[model samples]
Target: MAQHVERQRYWEAQQAARQAERLARKRARSIDWSAALRPVEPVPIRTETLIAALASGLIAALLLGDGVGPGLLIAAVPAVAAAYVAARAAGRRPRPWTLVWGVGSLALLVVPALRESAWPSTLAILAAIGLGALALFGSRTWPGVLLSPLGLLEAAPTGVRWAWQGVRARRTGNARNVWPVVKAAGVGIALLVVFGALFASADAAFADVLGGVVPDVSVSDGPVRVALFVLGVVVALAAARAAGAPLRWDRVTVAPGTPRSPVEWALPLVLLNLLFAGFIGVQLAVLFGGYGNVKERTGLLPAEYARQGFWQLLWATVLTLVVIALALRWAPRSGPRDRRLVRGVLGALCLLTLVVVASAVRRMDFYVHAFGLTRLRVSVVTMELWLGVVIVLIIAAGVFGARWLPRAVMASAGATVLALGLLSPDGMVAESNVGRYTEQGKIDLAYFQSLSADAVPALDRLPEPLRSCALRGINDDLADEGEVPWYGMSLGDRRAREILRERPVKASFETCAGLGTFRSRSEY
Candidate 1:
């Protein structure tokens, strides 16, 4: 019986080992190790790429603007030019689509301008990001559109490899140039071994002279700067290469070409319509129910009553966009009446969403009036304005069967951003805040003090001691006239310096409390 039990245990152990071996074999089969062994082709450094690299570096060094006025407006020109040049390099004629790419580059250039305009950096950053994705992938259907620039991130390893190859080539070239010196040093080392020993043995003074000839360079921040320079070069080169050769549309596709069965779309959308209608009814009450009644009903503060609706409306707007996109992309071929019914429902939803947008804008206005102006408040107003435009476009598409709806929406958005870039954001903010202060006399001096040089001209419009004091404060802070290189020169800062130098703050420049926008938009 003991022998039989031992035999059973041995057989079980063997069975387990065999199972483990089989599992390992299965896992190995699942992987394509051929890719790991395959060599990735290097991105050849051509004349076009080299030119782009130089331009990118120069732009980075020069066109990087601060919270200076329309300095970004000026900086944006080169970026657009670069994109146009790059698009041309792709051996394509300057098509209208290439011009769209130019607009994207312009959008990037305006980020700083938008921030300097008076709204926060977040708005500008988001515009640049969205436009960047559009420029890269050329506004394909969903999922693929989202993956456009993110795909660049996925190629991080490839970028790193290209960068490494660049560095290696540079090092190899440098080594060739220094080879003679290295060879001479080897000979000198041999001579030193043959003669230095004799000289040191003959006289200790000769060894002392040799040691004195070698000067010790002290270690400091030099290495850190060198590392930063290297990092900048690598990053700029990578970005240049990518931008010059943007992702081809064919390479990134979304199959919105075919429609799904009508049955699959109809029921889901009908259910959505019921849900949205119920939500809209609530929104209607929120809009006209009066602030006090809503406050009492909800048991919230006046500010809370006002602040919460904008976000809800924003979500509704986004949801509407998603639904419309879904319907357009996947709804199957239907009879005329069914299609008409679907279109009618979608149109009603959009119209209702427009009402929601209006309510949101109203709530934001109430909140701002109650509290004060913030970047977020101002940015939301701008975004909602854009959302309203989108809804109008959607309605147009549905009503007129406009095939250009998507492109129009995108183009209009780009146009709006450029419009903002042209406007004085900082000046607008300052003007608004100053006007508010006049009405209520609630001034945040610290906030004003932190305002960029762009705000100086705006603050100049304020009356008396306030104007003089603010001007002096700004002048004193931006007092240091650092070495102004031709590159990295900020027009706004330069203007501030000039104004400070020219005016020197006389008591006479002060005026009455109320003043309209005194400077032209360009000057601000």
Candidate 2:
């Protein structure tokens, strides 16, 4: 009986091994490639590649066309089409040639309009759009360039590579139940607090610390305040992380039945906007009137007077209320209609800006002269251009919006503007002008004063090296009058006298000889 039992066990073991082998073979053979490799969605043509093709085509058409007029329109179609094809082929990983074609096509789109009338403001708008496109193109390789850190924080969680890995690991036995995420959050919060405190403290202490002295009370308080703020933010972030909430980009998705209709969203935003308008109106009213009070008391620029202490608090309160109202309106419960209302409000706001600009210009003549404010006779021309660009972006947000024609036109417009800015006279203005001069002590006073009244203060505050040169120029004028005529004086004194001697070329004066011995003389 024992032998028979042992035999049965041995047979069972062999059968089990054979069955395992068969199962492995079956599993290998049953592998489905389509299921494994299928994309989540169909790949669309890349916007940049299309843009490039359109640009190139536009150029070719324009060059080859019979006349300037016909060539532009005929060229645009081929350019846009070529771009579309190239973009589709390039998809996620585009070729250099693809980009080249797209860029070339885009140049064609704007060359005709721009060549016809070289408008600066129009060109600026086109330039901004082109920059945006270029940034979008670069995003394929270096995604961070187009995205802010805040954008990354929001969008990174939805991405397939990093987020998917984490998700899959959790699903499988390889990872624990969200415990690692919590741990990471906790650790990140702790590190943030520590680093923030250290940075704030070090910055506050830098000058004193180098000299081995303690910072003042205010400086010492910086680290403590910064640490508290960082701690609060980290704690909030940790709490959110613990809740397993998905990161938000900008939009808040809502459940279908939640009162997400448009009117709910619109009302609050509308009210808030009106409140903002009222606040602005009141402030301007005060400004217009405040001048009277200050003028009566003391003669000063209109910029000098204000109820700063109380008015600031009042403005803050008003702004805070407006923000809260807007936020309440923006919540998901307000729905799609709310978005439309917000858009309308935005448009109205733009209109208000135009009105304000017009009023301000009317009040200030120098502003109109300096900015060339009324060539178009329309307020917010630049703003309108920006609005158009924003509209294009909105259209492109839809899946089908990333097309050849628009992208190409946009790209061409951009390249044309860029070329113009670099190669034209206006570009000279952009290049020559610096924002402001802050290195006061390094500049020469007399030289600076000679340039403009603005530089007088800066020149007066100059450091030793440049100040000496300035003082010498001043002293030279003074010394030239007192010098004796007997063979003159030293080289410095003679030079001073000569400088004093210099008159306008129109004022003819004769100088025969100087110095008692080996005298030298020059024309005056």
Candidate 3:
């Protein structure tokens, strides 16, 4: 018993010693102050970068402000200030961020100005720059960059120049690495090329599209317009440079996943480029020739506009989808199930829509033959209603039924194959024809005369060219067939009932309220 007790005591003492030693080691590790904090490396801010950022903003302001050159300066100040603040934090007394911000702001301003200069456009450019700056400064790797004066470096464009500079600087003990700069420059150049191609191609296409409408309107021969356009492009390029600074390369960096596949990373960009070119480049050319608003003046039917928009949208969608595919390539890896789940839901919804459409087709035959209902309008309405119902089903399926639907789709693939084969071709052709017809008949200025006063308000609220169209529709109808001829009246008289008359302008809110308070218009 004595021996056993002694042995037990020895084991207990050993355990206590072991525990004590562990604790001591842990304490020692905790108290090791040298390992607690990382050494702070100082970074110097470049003066040239600061100047560039501000200069960019200034140029943007000038371009956006139109002939009112001061607008550019006004717009550039905020960016300059931002740059300065950033530089101060980088242990440098320079203001490159401000300079770049100014430049970016200027670039943004110029593009809009070259298109159509206005306060709203200026505001939009400024807003974009501000948001971009916020995003750059808010990032995890460089939140301190925002606080640092050199944060503007984070805003530099990605390209050959940036890469070369980074390389040169790093080699000469001026920068850390040239890789980022190179990456930025390369991306920027790629995007520029893409955009340029889109612009050039779209511009050419516009010549064909606008051939029947405004054939005579030509580009301005004056150097001013050309200069403006050049300025706009330069500003855009500068802005692109600035914009390239904050890309999460880790997130967007491509990796070889599942080997090479049919879909590629460049596909999305291709789609995006095509869509942008089609919509914007085409539209610009059309506008330059003064036919951009022709649809409104031509009294184009609503169906026509919808059709035209459809073709454009279809191309746009294709482009967008391709671009999305490419973008997804660089996106962070996700589960296969998660990725496919969305498509599955969409397929289910489409199936549901097919069911609904089938039901409608059955009803149509009964209504047409048995009920002796043969009116074109009624037939059209019936078909539309059923189609609409199917569409709703598809949308619902996509939104809510995606997860399990894919599995079901695979299970019922055999049945679906037959139905889809039959339905796909006819439906696609009909839809396409309808789309084309609609575009061909799209509304323009001639129909403006037919709209009622009630419709005028909505039309007036539309963007410039379109609003003018709605107005024409309303006035034309009034002149030809309305009971009252209220032509030559100021804008206020048309809206007089809703507007108060206390202020000089009846539509002024203060005047309206004041007149209403006094009960003058109502009493009269």
lDDT of each: 0.58, 0.37, 0.38
Instruction: Kindly provide the TM-score of model 1 when superposed on the true structure, using C-alpha atoms.
Output: 0.62
Selected candidate, larger TM-score, 1 vs 2: 1
Who wins the TM-score comparison? 1
Candidate 3 residue-wise lDDT at 201: 70
Backbone clash total for model 2 is 21
Report the lDDT tens digits of candidate 1 across residue range 102-153: 5665565555543333343444545665565556445444433455556445
Each model's TM-score? 0.62, 0.27, 0.23
Worst 10 residues of 3 by lDDT: 515-524
TM-score-wise, the better of 2 and 3 is 2
Comparing 1 and 3 by TM-score, which wins?
Answer: 1
Selected candidate, larger lDDT, 1 vs 2:
1
Give residue 401's lDDT in candidate 1 (0 to 100).
73
Question: Which portions of model 1 miss their true places by more than 4 Å?
Answer: 1-45, 58-90, 107-126, 129-139, 151-240, 243-246, 249-305, 323-332, 399-409, 440-450, 468-491, 495-524
